[model samples]
Target: MKIYSLSKIAIVLSVLLIFILLGALWRVSAVPQTSLIVQDEQFFEVKPGANMTSVLRELAEKEVIEPSFWQSVWIKSNPKLANIQQGWYQLSIGMTLLNFVQKLHVGHVVEHKITLVEGFTVWQWLEQMAATGDIIIDVSYDHDAFEYQFTPLSKHHQMTIREGYFAPDTYAYAHQAKASDILFAAYAKQRQQLKALMSEFTLPKFIHNEHELLTLASIVEKETGTAKERPIIAGVFLSRLAKNMRLQTDPTIIYGIGPSFNGDITYADLRAKTPYNTYRINGLTPTPIANPSLASIKAVLAPEQTDALYFVARGDGTHEFSKTLAAHNKAVKKYQLTKP
Candidate 1:
């Protein structure tokens, strides 16, 4: 009878112990494990091959997650949690521990952004990419990779890195994003943008194909500052092209001179026989001088119909368009020669 009584007591104690453990797990799981107050956002990286234990320890050390023995127990209970992906992660306030672990396991990481501005040269674009602190710029990678990657965009197989094929816009990427990834994104976006724009407008008589249209658009972009003036300036270039007149645009001369070009263009520079020198070469430059915006590209396809062939800057970030050389010379004297 004493033995029976002892067995009953032992059974009751075992049941009570199981209930106590279940209550503890429920309490820990419901309580907030982190009190991170994300203002803008929080960024962190998990190195390749980082295991869950080390990762959780680092997160606790950083105060991203509250350190708790129960939390470790919960995480270790699942064998699938072992496959944590390595990359940057953006964490925010009010995220549950369960949600965070799931995101890490699936490799959902934070994305970084870099903006490539309109009218930026290829070199300028590279500099912008390097300026973004998040990306890993591959110094040894050849910049000419664009040639093979975007062969159809080039007029010939000899397309150099200087060709303005990359579309100018803001781009987002994950951490450790390479320079090629950014460039290729820009290029791909530009191709899509150009293709869409092409379908919307009939190709102007002067623009024979996509390559020529982009070349003209780049010139129009460099020549004008005002967005409203793009179509008008495109008209002047088209008119010049129609009449077989020398483009006489100074930007082309500056482009030909390349890095050696000082702030100013000289008379000798105009006469210099470079492929990009519009004064020496009759048609468009061998390639685009800078990446043209979508608006500029659109303007080239649908130019403002006008007989005006000349424009002089009005010094107030505008230009005075004229129909004849005589009128052009007069405007140049007023705007250029009489500048204070």
Candidate 2:
């Protein structure tokens, strides 16, 4: 009887231990796995001063992570999680709980992008930067302060930051980046691009320095609608410069008029004298009229060897080039005057 009682007690104890082990295993498996979440990707922000409970609640609300008894127990056990840094985070589906916590703790935030287009004016670029909701813009357009910011990049002693000084491209930054920081990056990129191009190609005789090259390039960019015509247009401008003839370019006349220009360039506007009016000025404009692409800059540096000194826009996206005034006039009559 004593042996039977002892055997019964041992059997009961063994069964109790087995049940306890099974419960422990179930709890471990219930902790959230990456595959358990339905969302493929999520962008979340933890505001400054948000506590751990609030963050977990917000995550649960977004359906990024589910709230359960096991998750709550996990959070309570890991007290260090409450100190997770606040910022934007991109979470992928199937991310393990451990990995997710690690990312938040390390403050691995998502980067945002902004693009500055080629041929845009400085004012236009500023407008686009201001439109980006995430950036903090403190730069004012009222004075020459912004121009002086780029003094380090200019080779000319008198040259300040001009319209074509910033490289046009997409740039990525962290959340709440300052506008000045973005502008400086663009300026640095443009300087680097110019340096690289100068090293690769021999500059034309008419382009004495970086300032002249950028000024002519901006005009070339505005004059040519097609990519292939950039070199030809550049050649025409260089030819005019060599012959001491007035550029007489319409874009320069319009630029001189500023906001008052109502889209129409009249004979009077051409006759009017302004710093940007190439029609009246004997040489290139005092500064770049607009930002030029790297290709346009390259075209100006090494223009195609051609005798063509004139071109007329055909009203189609292309232009007709001519070596003499008579041919140019005839082409203009056919393409411009005869257009129905």
Candidate 3:
């Protein structure tokens, strides 16, 4: 009789403990979580293939959430709603467990912005973009690697790094994005825009293909003294090309000198026989010196109607357009020589 009575008491005690545990779990589910002590600016990264259990354990250790095995159980019970997406998630205090789970499941990943400026070299562009520190730079900034990785605009197009193919604009990217991702995005946008614009305007005889047009646009982009002067500069370059005259643009010479070049450009640098020296070469540089803006690109396709074949910067951020070399020289003497 004593042994039977002891067994009944043990069963009752086990049932009571089970009820207590269930009640605790019910409170955890119904109540808002306050264990999170992480700052508003803090972010938790949920990597690919990460499970909720391990993530909850990690959060507990980090004090981002209270330690509870039942929370993971709660997640497992509702697998559909608890499925977290992979990316950076901003963590904050006073968030319920459901709120946390739903936020990750819905994929509210943090994003960063990068702006590629007009007339920036490919190297400059990459360096500036990498400043975000979350991007993966798998490929080096070179023609061989980029060409092999990305598809050409057309089968006839030769893929090159210095082709001025990537568009200049502010791009938004998630954390841990690849450098090639940004490159491909910019290239795709630029390619699409170029295609649409090409249909609107016809290339001159001197400009053979899209490559030549981009090359001219890059020159026009760099030579532009002001936003309003882009069309005029483009016209002047087109007139020079039509007249069989050398472009004689300074930006190309500076590009030929490479990154080691200081701000100053000497007569020797101008006379240098580099492939990019338009002053010495009879036509456009072998490749674009820098990326061009949309305005510059548009200006090249539909150049302003003007007889002006030359332009000289007038000390300030403006230029003096001249139809004759004598007038150009006079403006240069007035602007370049006499400026303090």
Candidate 4:
């Protein structure tokens, strides 16, 4: 009877030991091995006021970590989860648990990408800037207000960074970036590129200032998307400018209408009196209509030597170039008036 009692106690103790061992093993496996999160492509921004528990929740939600079990053990074992710092860090594969924890404690953060596509207006770019949420800037499509506010800056430096002055390109911004920082970055990039491009070509004879050059480049950008077409479009605008004829560019009319552009251009809208109405106002608009691409800038700086005075869209993504009003009317009739 005593031997039977000893065997029963021994079995119970052995089972208890096995359970304890398993628990230890599970905890060790739960601890992260790498500092990098392999789950999501975007940089996970752990905002201010986010605690260890909240961060763990985000990690689990993104499948970066194995949910709550490890966190529970970590909290129980560690003294207040240590001091986790906030910053960008590269996530590497196979980082060890203590190292990963140490990274959080050190708080090394990483930067993310913000891409600005070509042909985007200032208003459109502002919307994109606002969407980042990391940056603080008031987005306004108000033409008069924005133009008036930045006119001095544009005029003083002959800087094009006011309206269509910022180049459209992919930019990297830190998680803590602000709107002005992003805008300034783009403006700086344009300045560098413009300087380099200026070295390669002579400025147009009619353009006395850098602002005028940028204004013409912006018009070229709006008129055509094809790189080959930019020079031709530039030529047409140049010819009109020389003739003292109104630019009459539709994009300028669209800009004047602001957000009311309903994908339809009306005759009355074209004749509407506004500062940006190129049809009524001779030469380029009071300000650039949209940001010009580098290709358009190059086209303006070194335009094709042509007497072409007009062009109409060829229904395709191309344009029909002409040298006279008669030729322009013919092309317009064939391309715009004729039904497909």
Candidate 5:
């Protein structure tokens, strides 16, 4: 070899580096176009315990991509990216082969959404959760199962059943995610939120702990149609609890009736005595009738200073609050009865 000066050697090396960069660009650009790769399926599932080599082979077998020997060599060179994550990967209509590979490399798996709505019972949530596809549920949904899932939370509060323990919100999870994990997440979130609320506000005798707070908040959640009305509704329930008046919230009776409720609340249902029928029971329900939102929970802690002891629906998904039964009955007559 001929001896070269440092400047000339640097120039030669720079030229070779440019050529290598171009080759690397070509390596990726030469792959398949940005198509969904979903000729017959919408998702590509990478089974658990699969390695990068096996995943590449599966992709090649499907004709999604055929990594040439050089490309394979390049992949092997990146040892950090040698393992593929496990989950179902969604292939959009405009996804490219490189985009798909990047998703597989980074564990950007397909995400499924589930909503735990406020004022809906745990049983309803389980029904919705269990009905979802690709969401794993290893255990049955029963009293014992719910108790087991809520044991961590029940250490402090009496959650004999996993009722108002779950925080109401929309959650996203990858395919093969456990439903129980989501359940615990919701529970843990509620615990954190309740703790925060308790720390923020001083509790009254009527509201003893997180369990009682959620119990009253669930009633408040069901009582109001408008979000702004939560504080007022919460105020009415708290006032009633303070004065030894029965809660008499219709939602409690509906919950007590369970699946037999036919979208109508009759006098008989109000008269029926159950642990949840606040019209018949004293003070708060033994447990939450349904999952309440944080707003409802906060509404209980920092209730609107009002003497309103009752509220009636205003026919337009609003409420008319009153300090006395006379005003409440008038509101009921105007809104609940026919437009006279």
Candidate 6:
């Protein structure tokens, strides 16, 4: 009778031990099964000072994971919950709980999606670049500094970073990246693209060097923002360049006046005697007014074969291209007239 009692007790204890082992194994298996969560295509920012519960709540709020209670329970049960790592994580939609935990434990942060669009002036880009956190491009870094450093390169037969010379692309970058490095990368990409396109073009007698072409492309980019108008604008500038006439691009005047120049181009701003003022310079500015798109670059390389020598904005994000001064004057009067 005593032996029988002993056997029953042993069996009960054995079953309890098995259950405990299974629970431990289950937790271990779950550590790697967390799914990635993405909300509205934005990565969650797991900043500093976020605790395990707060992180879970943030995940829940972002719709990357389920309700807070579930995550809270899971995190509490996990042995490695003390190692809640923080950074900008690129969580996907429908991420599992375990994978999410692992990501935090590993401290994986998503890079910033820095999109430098075409037609942004250097000063405008500098402001946007500064807005991103931990970026080191000081607003105090003078434009003259960049120009002075690059002028020597131009003398060495190398192209400098000028308007329309940087590639317009969405680049993935760390938050800690330097501003100068970002600008340099964009310029390098532009050079690579230019080299490939330059091989394709058989230029005429008038267009001699790469700088002249890039200068013309920058003017085309500034004259019209619409893609459809780029080619026609390029023709007008190319024609003007051929005739030794002033490009008279308004963007150049804005560039001359610096960041103080608002979008409004005043008559006095046009008459400004700065080197960047196309009205005064009678040709392309020493630097580009803004970063031109690839379409503008290609337009300069393969300009539309036309006799257009003038263009004026229609205030509708398009341009009126003309072959004669009379025709251009008529367009200006029709489009530039103010409605009281």
Most accurate candidate by lDDT: 3
lDDT of 3: 0.79
Model 5's alpha-carbon lDDT is 0.75
In the range 209-316, model 6's lDDT, one tens digit per residue, is 776677667777777768887877777777777788988887777767776766788878777788888887776777666777888888877777788888778877
What's the CA RMSD for each of the models? 5.3, 6.2, 4.5, 7.2, 7.8, 7.6
Q: Order candidates by TM-score, high to low.
A: 3, 1, 5, 2, 4, 6
Clashes of each: 0, 1, 0, 14, 0, 13
In order of appearance, the predictions have TM-scores of 0.76, 0.71, 0.85, 0.71, 0.76, 0.66
lDDT of 1 by residue, 91-210 (tens): 777776667777889999988777788887766676777777776554231332322222333233243344578898889989767766677788899889878887788889877988
Model 1 alpha-carbon drift over 4 Å, by segment: 1-42, 47-51, 57-72, 78-86, 91-102, 105-108, 139-162, 259-262
Q: Write candidate 5's Cα lDDT for 1-340 as tens digits.
A: 3556777898999999999989977774564343544565477889888877777678778776655554565566666666668889987666776677688889898888999878887777767777886666543434423332433323333333457888989988777677667777888899888787777788856777777888888888878799998888888787888889888777877776775579998877777787778878888877677889988888888788898888888888888888888998998888878675
Residue 146 in candidate 1 has what lDDT?
24
Q: What digit string (tens of lDDT, one per residue) describes model 3 on residues 122-231?
A: 77776786776777654444442322233343232244455589899989988777767787788899999999998888986688999998889999998887899988
Q: Each candidate: what lDDT?
A: 0.79, 0.78, 0.79, 0.74, 0.75, 0.70
lDDT of 2 by residue, 69-123 (tens): 6676666767786568888877786677767777777888878999888887766
Runs in model 5 deviating more than 4 A are 1-37, 57-81, 93-97, 130-132, 137-161
**Top TM-score hit:** 3
lDDT of 1 at 315: 88
lDDT for each residue of candidate 4 in 1-340, tens digit (9 for 90 to 100): 9999999999999999999989977765667543545743445666677767777777778777766566656755775556676665555665544655666776767666888777778777767877776655533345554451323222222333367768889988777565556667777888898899878877887776667888888888878956788887888888788889888888888877876689898988877888788888877776777788888888888888898888889877899888888999999999999966
| Residue 188 local lDDT, model 4 | 86
Order of quality (lDDT): 3, 1, 2, 5, 4, 6
